[model samples]
Each structure stands twice: as structure tokens, then as C-alpha cells.
Target: MDDPDSNAAQLASPSYRLPALDQDFLLGDSMRGVRFQLEFAKAEEVLRAWGIRTTLVVFGSARVREDGPGRHADWYAEARRFGKLASLRGGAMRDVGQVRDNVIATGGGPGIMEAANRGAADVGAPSIGFNITLPHEQEPNGWSTPGLTFRFHYFAMRKMHLAMRANGLVVFPGGFGTFDELFELLTLRQTDKAPPIPVVLVDETYWRTVIDFDAMVSHGLVSPSDLSLFRFADTAESAWQSLIDCCLKPHPPSDYVPVP
Candidate 1:
């Protein structure tokens, strides 16, 4: 019902958009490669701006609660304590100008992830939560620092962010997702794609019952040296200490900077 000239004018207006405003175009397969770069850069830019030089990834079952269940209760407590200890000792609680190292990072959901991020919060330090969309609905734990929390649609991109700045990886009792991350690091270490950072599994009892790394070695399926790729810790203190022993030197001077 409009004149041809007015119709043409409306079409040329700013309100008339291109494919840039089309969600279908952006989410389509043809734009996947662009999405990948955006995913990588988005997290990287924020992390860099925040001065996150190193990261310590904490992985575990989302089902574990702070108290309700038995072993779950114990693990939740231990993970929380470990988060505090790691943040205190690893430099997350240092003054703004001080060197920041091993900033606590987690899957950014409840369970052990919340415990770890909560520990860092206890010390009034910033922590990171790398969460992914899931069928069952996983949300970022509230304990993680506000600006540092991130959500990703792609699992590969999510894992990339986890490992990229990782200085240590600590795994607690968990199932498939935990195992996926745990073994991915192991494989990267095994294949020499990753540097030998400390990889500690919480609770010797749980880990031993779950998998037989020794059996794998005995069967010649894996070399005996492969077993050294990870070790076990029964408490938070021991776990954080092992990371210091395995990869980090004693807390450096506040002003210390590595000479390149």
C-alpha cells in the first residue's frame, strides 16, 4: 500500500539490515569457522586483560554436593579447602600488582567446581568458570568471579580455553565429563602436545577402584612410565603441594619477573 519511492527509501534505511543481523546466517554451518575464531578470541582477550598468566583446572562430578551424600560431602569439603590453599599459595590472593599464578579455574557449575571456585572466593580473589551448554542444563556457579565466568557452545572451544593457560590440572572423583578432560590432558602429555604440568587425582581409594592404570601397564597396553603421568592425593593440602613440587617453584618474590 506504499508508494514505490517510499518503499525503496524504507529498504535503504538503517533499520533494514543485512545477513549480519540474521541469527540463521550466523549460526549456520557456513559460518562455523568464524564462530571458532570468535570463541577463541573472546575468552583469550578477556583473560589477557585480566592478567591471567596461569590457570589450575579443577574437574569433578557435578552431582557431588557440599553435604548431603557421604563421599560426595567429603570430596566437596576437600575440594573447597584445596581451592583456598591453592589460591593462597599460588598467588591468586596477592595484591593487584603482584604476580598472579595458578588462578583457580573450574567447569563453572555446582559440585566440586563450585567448591573450588568458592575457595578462591573465600580469599577474595578472582576465579574463572568455563561452562558449556548441555542437554541437562549446566549453569555457572555463583562463586566464580563475575567478569571471569564464560559460557561456550562448542566443547572443543571450551576445552581449548581450559588447557591453553593451564599450569596444573587437578581431578577429583567424577564420571564421563571428568574422565574426558582428565584423559584428554593425559593424552596430550603422552603425545607431547602439552608440557608436563602437575596432574593430580584426588583420593587414591576412589581413583584406584575406578580404573587400573597399573593393569594397563602390566598388560603392556601402556608403558610403565605412562603411570607417572598422574599421581594421587588424599587431601587438598597434599594435592596443591604436589603441584608445587611437580611444576612450580616456591612462591617467587612479589616483584619477580622471569627473564626472557
Candidate 2:
């Protein structure tokens, strides 16, 4: 029977047992879904390329306006200070010598993120920013250097990049995202999945009221030594000095030659 049209119609219909990917039976917007999936893959590749090293991750709020008060302002201001210092030292060392490669990195958005990026740029030092695409928030701050700013679709991958490369983590006062990052890093170290990288909780006033490390100890959820995983700092200078002491010791196990 000459019924080719009818046969084609049956093959395309849902009732007919067909292949897995049916353009008709797809969920949500197909273009949007595929875009996100591609983005996720690209992000993983970008993060993996950075490799393991002594990197610093600065987690903070993206909504922090250039001006604010209390914790928000303090976090951004301190980030700026420390970022610039790190950049300067990095530049100086890389120019004629190779002391270390502790590049300052951030979430690649505004607020404290901006402060950190700004600081790095201020000293003309290359930095990294793991930018996430969001409809309402999370745009790469102006301070993020060209070629160093990257966007990620998966929060987990972005966070993984941060932890994998970090020799230390400096967390500024922030909301849910900040707390999530802080806990994850602490968990990794406590669980022995990751090395004991120095975690500095900036702004003691804000941090103390927000989360109780003692409470974790009180409930027997964590050991007393877990408290040693982090320390409190109030200023950029203090925090940078802490980093110098902790991560920037002479590499290669060789004696450090002081600058004459």
C-alpha cells in the first residue's frame, strides 16, 4: 500500500516507541537547558586547568554596594587592602625573582568580591574570579582582570576550583552562600578529604554573632582541634600578615633569602 505519509506520522508520534531524545517530549526550554549543560562542562574544564597550587579564595557578598556600613563595608574594604598587597608582592616577586605564586582570587562579582578584585588590579597583579551566571545577581566586578575572569554554571564546580587550588581561604561576612562555602571547606579539612589549609574568618564581630564554632563543639559535632582550622582577623594588614606567615614561607624547603 502506498502509505508513506502515514508511516512517517506514526514514527514521530509519542505512542510509537521511538528513540530517547524526542524534540516534542523535552522538558522545560530546550535551548536554555542545553546552554546550561554546555556551560557546566566548560566550567569544569576551566577549573581543572588551574591545577593544585597555593591559591587564595575570598568569599563574600556580591550585593555589597561600593558604599555601605558595618560588616559589608568592612569586608569589602579589607578585601581591597589585602588584595592589593598580595598583588604587589606577587608582581615584585615575579619580576626578577620567584618567591611564590599566591594569586588573590574571588567570586568575580561586586561587594567584597569587587574589593578583592580591585585590590589585585590595583597592584597590577593577575587574579582569578569564578563568576557565576545569575538572572538577578552575580556579575563580574570591574576589578576582575581581563583573561582571568571566568564564568561557571555549576556552583559545586566553582567551589571545587576554589578549594582545590587554595592554600588558604579568607571568608568575609556574607549570607547563605558565604556560610555554605565556609562550612564546606571546614568539612573537607575535618573529614581529612583535603589538606589543612588556613581558613581566616574575617570581621570577628560579624562572624561571632553569625555562627558559633563553640556550638559545634558543644553539640559534639566537631572536635576541639577543628577550631584551630580558622582564625579571626579585623584588618587587611593583619590578614595579609597572617597569610605571609602561613602560606608564603620559603618554597622548595630552601633557606629564605631576605631582600637586601
Candidate 3:
């Protein structure tokens, strides 16, 4: 007869656990690559299931609130307006065939992200929020479609998801995080790694004050043509129009039935 203690010990052994059910094993350093792949696949699958074919990515400061000081109110209001305008005009309102294009996507936090998501909600359109885990926990804005909101621990994976299906990019005033996202996409465009998509920066005065693209050109830091990668707009309507001018083709009306 087998010893009961020995049998119990064997059953409780970590090695004997199923890999998929083993949290310690899954979260270990050796599984980092697997975690990255999981992050990519999970978001990809949900997005595909939702018929999100492409997105108009919005980047901005999470610090800007509608009631905040100075230009914050205007910026917030405009961002919200842009979200609604884009959704109404960009085929995100179409439920036919479950193929949504140019849906608004943001970082899934408060401030500008919340405003954009709220705008889409106001028009009864679904939007996406890609939240990330930070030292200070970031709560997802309530406006993003619950199923479409996601959280990622890996910045690279999050950035990958942001860039992969972008039809266009609209950047509002922001700080370091926003700049990181903006420049990454611009670099991709400049190097031909990403397809030429419309890039618009809202608030010409603010952008010019913050960065001297023309000076970069004169100093030979960047070629004169590189400055053409993005254009500036003072309002949400003009920003959208700039995208249209840059040949952002809105999805055409379709008669196909939604997938059940």
C-alpha cells in the first residue's frame, strides 16, 4: 500500500500542476515572452471579434480636465467634439457586417481620454481604450465600451496594438507620454515602416511653442521633408479636415448584415 503522506505530497507538487493553471510558472521570468505574446493575442482576438478593422488613435495629456484652468476647458471640449465628429463621419456608427473602421482609440485613462470616450458614448458609438499598468494604478474611463477596454503590462505590446491598425492619428496637447506616442508613429512614417497616414496636431500655437520643427530642419537634425509628416490645426474640425485632405478615406456605406 502507498504511504498517504507521500501520495499527498506528490499531488501538491508544483511540477505536477497543469501549466495553464500554474500562476507562479506563468508569471515567472522565463515566461516573459509568453506573457508578451499573450498580451498581443488577447487584445487582437477581442478587437477582431468586435469587428474593429481600423482606428483613429488619439493621444493627449491625462491631466487636462474640462473644468481645469486656462485652455484646459477648450481642449477638453474640442477633444470630445472631435471624438463624436469622427465617429459619426468615420463609419464607426455602422453595425452592418460588424466591420468597424476608424473607431476612436485612446489610452483608457481620465482627462482627455475620458472626454474622447464620453463623446463616442454620447453618439452611441463603440470606442476602445488601451489602458496600461503603471506604478500608480490607472483606472479606465467609464466611457469606453466595457468589452473593448483593455489593460496591458507591457508598453511595447500596448504600442504595437496602437500602431498596427491606425488609419490616422490626432494628437492634442500633452507631455512626455504623449510625445513618446506621437514621435513613435512619426518615426514609423518617416522611415516608411508605416503606411502614409494622416497625422494632425491640434493647437498650432502650443505645438510650435513646445517644439521647433523648423529649427530642426535648419540645424540639419531632420530633413525639410520630414516636417511634412504632420500638420497642425487649431480646432477639431480643421484637424479632421486635414486628415481628409491628407486622403483619409472614410469607409463607405454598406448594406451587409451584422454577424450574429
Candidate 4:
């Protein structure tokens, strides 16, 4: 026979807690796989609900600022302009469709990321910010749609989400972090691990100075054909055109016309 006090104690014990409610157990080392799945599923479910079918990912330096020194302002402005242009023409403005293509996606932090997100906000289009947990604690830019902003602890998981839905890639001048992401996608493209997608490097002069593709070819570090994987553009208009030339499909204007 169970005494009332003993029954109460048993019910309150940690061991008796439901698995889902046991934070200690759920966060333990053994549950890492479960945590990974949870991370993936949480974002996937929300994206599906929001009908984000394809994304135009923008990668750039977080150090750039609108009013900062030198070409930083130019880079920021172009990124913002590209974001708005892409949203306006890339089917992201369609209210009647169940799918949104070419929606602007960013790192969800400041600098170029904030500029792109702000561009989407300019025309009242929803954007995505895939933020990562960093030691310095990067915050999501205010321009990304509140419901679509997400933070992940694992860089691998964050990158997977970024790459999995990308329809095109627009890269701006950046340093180590940006190079990491740029090369990863380039490698995937070279190996055919990812489907062919348009890749545009904004500011041909900046990119040419930063990466010596010709030198790579001369050194046999990369094949001549590998250089064809991406193109260079000097402005937002040219960047969009480069994507179009490389077969980044945009929905017909009629499909995005608002229903009265």
C-alpha cells in the first residue's frame, strides 16, 4: 500500500518526470542527436508553414556599415538595393501563392546582413535571418521577419539550412567568415554536390583583388572550367542580370499580381 506522502514524493521526483519535460536528461551529452534533430525540425516546420520554397542567399562582411569609411558604404548600399530588387522581382512579393521564391536570406546580424534584410523590409516583403550562436552573441537584425528569424548553436546545421533552400548566391566583399561560406558552396558546385545555381560576386574589382582566380588556374590549384561557376557584377542591376543569364528563374509578373 502506498502512503500519501510517499506517493507525493514519488510523483515529484526527477526520475518520475516525463522525458520531454526533463531538461537535464534532454540536454545531456547522449541527447546531442536529438538536439540536432530538434534544431533541424523546428526551422523546417516554420519555413514550410511560411511557404519559403527558394531563397536567394546574400553573403558579406559583418564589418561593413552604411556610414563607415571608404567603399563600405557602397557595399552596404548595393546589398540593400539588391535585396529590394530581388524581393520585388523574384516572386517574394506574391501574396496569392503558397510558395515564395528568391526571398532574401542573410546571416541575421549587422552590416551587410542588416542592409539586405532592411531592403526586403523596404517593400514590405518577408525575409529570413539564420543567426548562429556565437561567443559574442550575434543578434538578429530588426528587418528580418520576426517569425522567420532563427538562431542555431551548430554552424553545420545553420549552413545546411542556408544551402538546402538556396536558388542563387550573391556574394559581396568579406573576410574570413564570408570566405568560409563562399568556398564551401563553390566546392559543392565544383563537385556537383549541389544543383547548378547562379553565383554572382558583386564588385568585380573587389573580388578580383581578394581572390586571384587566374593565379589559381596558373598554379593548377583549380581548373579553368571551375572559373565558369560564377560571374562578376559591378552593381545590383548587373548582379540580377548575371543571375538571370545563369538561369535563375523568376516567376512571371502575372503570377504575382495582387488579387483585388
Candidate 5:
């Protein structure tokens, strides 16, 4: 005969567990807000714990390859060199009495993002990558500091994280995604939603050839002052100089404490 005690042991208790623990419930439409919060908080917690007070966000294409494409390879080289320069001089290497500032941050994918992260690595400074999950399968580049790599399912959350602690923006030649990130920051700066920070657009010929900002002013679409929001840099040193000239240098994190 079957053991009656075994039958009782086999019974499951659906009410014993919290509904929030259920993956199906968590993935449903009712839990979308919760998912967003999770995405934001997880990275926020990690970054905070890592002592990242501020960031210099680098926006660029993921398609560029070193020694494989046209002018893109040159762009990659410049981005990497600029990354190293920024990390070395932007207070990236934390000291006993000072907090790290303006650490290299990227979209956390291949191409220029990889170069920037690799550049930071060259100086052994920490870097960040805000990677977004795509339907087509994109992953974080290998160069970003391991613990600082974050994957975000929500683009809005990812964008928020990118802009929140940003002290400056370094944009390189790219396609639609790059344009979106650049314009998003520009729009924020124009509206005073984001404070004035140096926005350096690398490769003057590429930018001018792609979009005619001067024409936008000529057409009276945007005010003349809007044109002043961004400047062009042809090399790594010039990019660093532009940040200084624009008074966009980063400050220590608000919560930083001085060591005795």
C-alpha cells in the first residue's frame, strides 16, 4: 500500500510563498515599475559602493573596428588616447585625500566604447559601462572594469543612469544611437535641466559633414547661442583642453569626506 504520509508530504503550498517571488508575476505588466526600479537601484548601489562620485560619459558607435574600417579605425585610436588623457588628469586615479572624479563611462559595447574603457584601463583607473539589453543581443565590451559593468533592460533607466552623475560629455562620430545620446544631453543643457558641462564633439570634418549646426542657426531653427553649446576636437589633447577651457572640470562627490 502507498504510504499516506508520503501523499501528505507531496502536497505543495502555493500560499506559503510571497507572490513577488514568483517570476511570472514579476514579469507581468503590473510589475513593470518594479522592474524599472530594480534596474536603476542595482547599478546605483554598485556604483555608489565603488566610490564613483562623477562620470565623463563617452558616446560613440559600436560598429567601428580597429584596423578594419575606413576613418573609423582612426576615430577609435583617438578615442582611446583621449580616454587615457582624461583618466590621468581628471582625478580618475583616486588619492588618500581626494575622491575620484570624471572616470571614463561608456555605452558598454564594442567599437569606440571598448576603446574608451580600454584607455581607462591603460592608466589602471576604474571605468563604467551602462549596457542596454537589445533584442538582437548586445553585450558589454571586455574593457570596462568588471564590477562596474551594468546591464539595463529599460532604455529610460539606462539613460537616466548615464546622465545623472555625468560631469562632462565626450561624443565621437557615430550613427543613430550616438545622435540620440548627444541630442538628449544637448536638449537637457539647453533647457537648463542639466547644468552646463563641456560637450566635446570629436572629428570636426565628420560632424560638419554629417549635420550642419550652422545651418540650423542660419535657418533660425535654434538660437545662435545653442551653437555654442558644443565644440569640436581633432585630437585627444585638444579634447582635454576644451574641457578645461569650458570650465567643465568635475568636483569631488558631494558626500566625500576628507581624510585626517
Candidate 6:
């Protein structure tokens, strides 16, 4: 017989044990959300090696193939190229687009995330990936720094980490999850919860169709000036240049301090 008090305690303080890679913990049809939470905690340990500060998040699609005239490849190549340029400034200085003090960050899976991480690795610069644990295991990209690949169970915590470490955000074409992330950041900025950092969206064709900024203005949904929140760039050169221009400008001292 199970004690009611013991059951209550278990519910209040959920505890989980890590299973071996081959083990199948899922039983029946029910999904245990807490499994992800535990996995996230386990992955956080990996990020401990790279303190979560001064990071740039490069987000895009994971399903994107490596070749075949895809914008995905273009996005990755550009990120890598810019990362190498940034790394030349040395690890001690800030890349503010050229300073190189911050690590390039991404989701640990493939596609755009892989591109960003690959870019950093190509330049021999450190990169960080905050990967999610799903029912289907998603492996870290080949370009990820050996020790820097991190896995996470909690989506909220992962987002928090991204918000905490990011000095800039570069977004590329992706799916639903990507939209969620982009909007979350936009909301945070609008609410004054986050400082205004450079937000660059790659691929003007897709973005223009997806986001009707002019319509929003026409409907009085948002102020026209609010459209300045993001800078759209079609090519890698334009994206890198936008970051350089923004970073080279003198940032207000208050904005430079890390949010506690």
C-alpha cells in the first residue's frame, strides 16, 4: 500500500533519475513532461564550462539540408565567415561584431544552428549550443565544440539561458519553434524586459511575406517607429555589416551591464 503522504511529497518535489542512452523510460501512451525537465538539468552541466555571458544566438531551421541552393547553406556560410572575422579580434575583446569576446551560440541540432556552430568552429573560435531533449534524440552538430554542447529538458530554462547570454540575435528561416523564439524576444523587448540588441533576420523574401510590418502600422497595431526593432538583410554581407554598424556605435553604459 502506498502512503498518501509519501505520494503527496513525491508530487511536490519531483525527482528523476537519468537513464542510459539505450533505455526506454516511456511506457504506455502517456508523455511525461518532467523527463524533459530532468534532461535539461543534465545538459546545463555541460554549459558550466562556458559561462553563459557575452553570447550571440544564431537561430534557423534544423531540417535544412547542407547543399542544393538552399538559403540555409547561405545562412550557415555567412555566419561562419562572420565568426572567423570576429574571432580575429581575439577572445579577450568584445566582437560587438568585431570584438570576438562573445561565443557564437545556437540550438545544438542541425540546419541553421549547425551553420552558426560550424562557422565558429571553422574559425577555431568557441561556440555554445543549447539543445533540447525530445522523444526522438537530436544529436549535436559535428561543428560543435566538443565540451560546449549542452542539452536541456526545460524549454523555458533554455529560452532563459538564451536571453541571459545573448548580446545579439541573428534569425534565419525556420519553422514553428523558430517563430515562437523570435516573437518571444520581440515581446520581451517591447515590454522593456530586455535591452534593445541587434536583431537581424536573414532572407528578405520569406520574412517580408511572413511579417507584414506595414499592415501592422496601417492597422495601428504598432507604431511605425517600432518597425525599427529589426533589420532585414538578404545576404551574409549585409547581415554582418548591420551587426558591425550597430556594435561600432557607442552603447549606453546601462545597456552593457548583464541583467541579473
Worst 10 residues of 4 by lDDT: 251-260
Clashes of each: 0, 0, 0, 0, 0, 8
Name the better of 3 and 5 by TM-score.
3
Error of 6 at 255 (Å): 28
Model 6 lDDT tens row, 1-260:
77766766654442443433313454212445656555656655555534434667778888776673756566666666655544333241233343334567788898888877776676566787888888899899888777777777678878987877677778888889889998899888877799877888988788888878799999999888777878888765677667766673322222243211
Instruction: Write down the lDDT that model 3 would get.
Output: 0.91
Can you write out model 1's per-residue Cα lDDT over 1-260, one digit (the tens) per residue? 77766678777765575877767778889999988898999999888878888889999999999975779999999999888777767767656655567899999999999999998898777899999989989889999999999999899999989998889999999999999999999999999999888899999999999998889988899899998888899999889788877966445436544312
TM per candidate: 0.91, 0.74, 0.95, 0.94, 0.90, 0.72
Q: Which ten residues in a row have the lowest lDDT in candidate 6?
A: 251-260
RMSD in Å for model 1: 4.3
lDDT of each: 0.87, 0.72, 0.91, 0.91, 0.87, 0.69
Off by over 4 Å in 3: 1-6, 252-260
Clashing pairs for model 1 are none
Stretches of model 4 off by over 4 angstroms after superposition:
1-5, 252-260
**Cα lDDT, model 4, residue 133:** 94
Q: Across residues 125-243, which tens digit of lDDT does each residue of candidate 5 receive?
A: 78999999999989889899999999999999999999999889999999999999999999999999998988999999999999999899999999999989999999877887898
Error of 1 at 236 (Å): 0.4
Tens-digit lDDT track of model 3 for 1-260: 87866778777999999999999999999999999999999999999988999999999999999999999999999899888888878879877467899999999999888888888888888999999999999999999999999999999999999999999999999999999999999999999999999999999999999998999999999999999999999888898899999999876345423212
Query: Could you tell me which residue pairs clash in candidate 2?
Result: none
On the 0 to 100 scale, the lDDT of residue 242 in model 5 is 90
lDDT of 4 by residue, 1-260 (tens): 77766678778899999999999999999999999999999999998888899999999999999998999999999999988888988978767446889999999999999999999898888999999999998999899999999999999999999999999999999999999999999999999999999899999999999789999999999999999999999888899999999999986346454221
Each candidate: RMSD: 4.3, 6.1, 3.8, 3.1, 4.8, 8.7
Ranking by lDDT: 3, 4, 1, 5, 2, 6
